[model samples]
Target: MATTHHTNETPTDVASNGTAPTSTVSPETLLDYYRQMVEVRLFEEAATRGFRQGKVGGYLHVYIGQEALARGFLDAFRKGDKTITAYRDHAHVLFQGGDPKATMAELYGKGTGLVKGKGGSMHLFDVENGMWGGYGIVGAHIPLGVGMAYSEAYRETGNIIQLYLGDGAIHNGYFHESANLAGLWGKDGMCPCLFIIENNQYGMGTSVERATANTNLGSKFDSYAIPWEKVDAMDLEAVIAVAHKAVDYVRETGKPYAVEAMTYRLGPHGAADFLEQYRSKDEVREARKRDPIGLLEQRLLDLGVTDEEAMEKIRAHAKELADEAVKFAEESPEPDLSELTTDVYAPETGLI
Candidate 1:
């Protein structure tokens, strides 16, 4: 088995060892990453509070500790790129230019939501932003992502698809089927998809060790002849570096690739998963030491990108945005009864 390791080195340190940092990514981009990460963290924290207060119903899965993984990849997104992911998707939508007010209103089941309050937390969608939908069913979106890539290729659009899935979804037959087809389709240069496996070590209560005979999640793509790699999710720079390379490879070669990000969920699987019976507090505590937001904050300071005061100001601004989102949701009206039958089917003219 390949050994998993952790690192505290900044991106510059890693590059200085031999590989130089890419010249294209500027200091402004790095600062923006830090700001976005802070915004996501604050947003999720507010969502958790809202869930506790009964503002949000159904299952609530906040992207707390896994901010860096999404931020890293989405930062590298281009005009023709599309993205899809699982239910833990609030951050994904927000980072991709989805309206925070509408997202929060969706959580509150208000008519002003992105999906008109019908989709709620798990089904956020924004076609304009190229965010398809966040699937509630485990592994269901895998096939959909591949299908989207195929459609893009068929249309000769040269667009890339970014498909995100959790560690647990890999065990599903849907994932395997999609991978097999992605491999076949890539042979014709028809599938430019980057399958990102957000391996947070557990699929709900079960750890990867308990769930799989072979725990190297990235290597699972080997069966389909797809290239794969693993990266430390705690480090934004590391993730950004790898993400740029992966996206470039898919864009240039028109093939599928996989990246297993070794990350951890600092919160319960959902708002109701209070017991957390599967893991110990010590394990959670240890993981907190490598908190992605904190890691990035320190890196920014070390790199002289910003000072402590400026960082704190960013944190305050993020919190203000999150607070305003909640207020927007609170003020937004609930979906009217007439809305029940409005979006049930397409118009007679044709499916729009």
Candidate 2:
């Protein structure tokens, strides 16, 4: 067996290296990232509170600190561009034009949800906005996104597919197998898939160092002959800049590309796990100081586009929106038992 080690002394930095891309946008773009990050941060916090208060139900995975990676990538793509991700998907769906009320209703298992109360937190689909769906099986959707790329290329559409997976999913055997196929497709200039690895330091409580031998994940794509890069998922500016470049590269070449986004989950792996034992309190605290939302808020103030009071107002507003979602969800009625037999098949015959 092969092994790699990381320590607190070691940077373990993927995008924080001095050579990573920096944002060169005007004040408006910086403020935009700040506003979106704050919005997502508050959204997740409110989601968590709702889950605890019994307003939101089922398995809730809060994308608390990884807002930059989600919103940054969403900003990089144009409308009708496709996006697929794993079950840490609330942020992705929301960024892809999903209404807060419908999303909240889905979490509440109400008839008004994005899935019409059919799929809960883990399974969300919005074909209208091109979100596709969030798969619960780990790494199962990798090939689905690649297949979408192939189909689109066949149809001569200019759109592209962005596939987001967590650090743990990267180690799954399907990841390597699907990557091999995606690379082959890209060689023919017919693939426009962006494989993003959201490296949040742990794969369900197992630290990346403890879990995998080849910890330099970006280099994995190197061996696959795919153009790849690493980015600071904690920094909205850096995330957006790198994602823009990667998306453009794939669009220009009609080839596959990968980005390893370095971030921390900040919340437990899911609602079921308290996420306490695997990491130290000091470590989480240190990571919080590098919070992407906080970083972008400071950047906005530095740019003078917004004052501290204004920024806080944005945060408060995001919370208020989430509160409204909770109220909408709580008041939603449960699905009728008679309808459980419907939508399972094409035929309208009742179950025996």
Question: What lDDT is obtained when candidate 1 is compared to the true structure?
Answer: 0.85
What is the C-alpha lDDT profile of model 2 across 167-191, one tens digit per residue? 8888888798888888998998888
* CA lDDT of each prediction against the hidden true structure: 0.85, 0.79
- The weakest ten consecutive residues by lDDT in model 2 span 1-10
Clashing pairs in 2: none
Q: Model 2 compared with the native: what TM-score?
A: 0.90
The local distance difference test score of model 2 is 0.79
* Candidate with the greatest TM-score versus the true structure: 1
Local lDDT at 132 for model 2: 87
For each of the candidates, the C-alpha root-mean-square deviation to the true structure, in angstroms, is 5.9, 7.9
User: Which residue runs does candidate 2 get wrong by more than 4 Å?
Assistant: 1-20, 346-352
Native-to-model Cα distance after best TM-score fit, residue 170 in candidate 2, in Å: 1.2
